[model samples]
Target: MSSPLAFDPARMFAVFGMRAVDSAGFDREVVQAPGDDLRCVFLWGKDCYNCNVFKQTAMLHKDALLDLGLTWFECNVYDDVALGQRFSLHGVPAFMMFRHGKRLGRISGWPGLPQFTEAVRRLRSGPAAPPAPASTQ
Candidate 1:
C-alpha cells in the first residue's frame, strides 16, 4: 500500500500506457484550451461521489501506466470551471479526449479497467496531430 499523499508518476504510465498525458503541471487556463496532441484526465475532488471512486481507480492504474511511460493529466474540477464546461462535463469521473483542441471522445462514470483501457486505445488510435513548437527561431 502506498501513502495517500504520495504521487507516483511511473505507476500512471503503466496502466494508461502510451495513450495518456500527465497534465499535473497544467494550469486551469491551459486545460480549457489544451493544444493539439494532449489528452487530459479531469479529477473531480472528493466532494462528488463519483470522483472518489475515480480517484481510487486512478491510483491503482497510475503505477501500471507510469511503468510504461504513458502520459496523463490530473485536473481537479474544484479548481477549474471553464475547463469543465469546455468538456461539457455533466458529471464527475469524466474522461474527455481531445485532439488539436477539439473533442474526440469521452467516457463518464466508473468504467472498469477493461473499458477504460479500450477507451484509451481508441483515443490513442485517433487522428490527432502533435502541437507545433513555439517559434523561437
Candidate 2:
C-alpha cells in the first residue's frame, strides 16, 4: 500500500514536472525570456495552508497548464525571499505570468477554481493596449 505524502513542495511539484526555481533561476529562465514566450511562475510558501490547497487544486488539471503553452515553474517564496521581493509579493499562493521579461499579470490567492481559471485566461491574453487619443475633428 502507498503511504501518505508529506508536504514537500519540491517533490510535489516534481511529480507534475514543475521544476523548482530559485530567484536567480527565475530571472535567468522566466525573466530573461528564454524564448520570448509566456512563462508562468507559481509562487508559493512552505507553511501556508492556502498554498498547499492551491497546489492540490492545480494538480487536478495539469493539462490546463499544457493547454496554456507557457513554461511552468514553481518557487518556494518562503525559502526564496528575494523572489518575493523582486515581484513585490506580499502574500503566498500567487501566479505570476511573464513575457519578454515583463510581467503580464498575476493572480494572487486561491479563491477557487473558477476564479483562478478566469484569472488565468485574462493573464494569458495579456495586458490590453492603450486606446488612441480621439481627434477634435
TM-score of each: 0.58, 0.74
Candidate 2 lDDT by residue in tens digits, 1-137: 54576445455577556767897767777777456566678899887988988777666666774576667788888888998998899898888877767777887887786786676677667644434689999
Q: With candidate 2 superimposed using the best TM-score fit, by how many Å does residue 51's alpha carbon deviate from the native?
A: 0.7
lDDT of 1 by residue, 1-137 (tens): 98998754444434454232234434443345555544556546446767766656667666654442323555556567665666677777776655565656677877877787777777777765756789998
Q: Which stretches of candidate 1 lie over 4 Å from their true place?
A: 1-38, 67-70, 128-137
lDDT of 2 at 100: 67
Tell me which residue pairs clash in candidate 2.
none
Q: lDDT per prediction?
A: 0.58, 0.74
Model 2 spans with C-alpha error above 4 angstroms: 1-12, 127-137
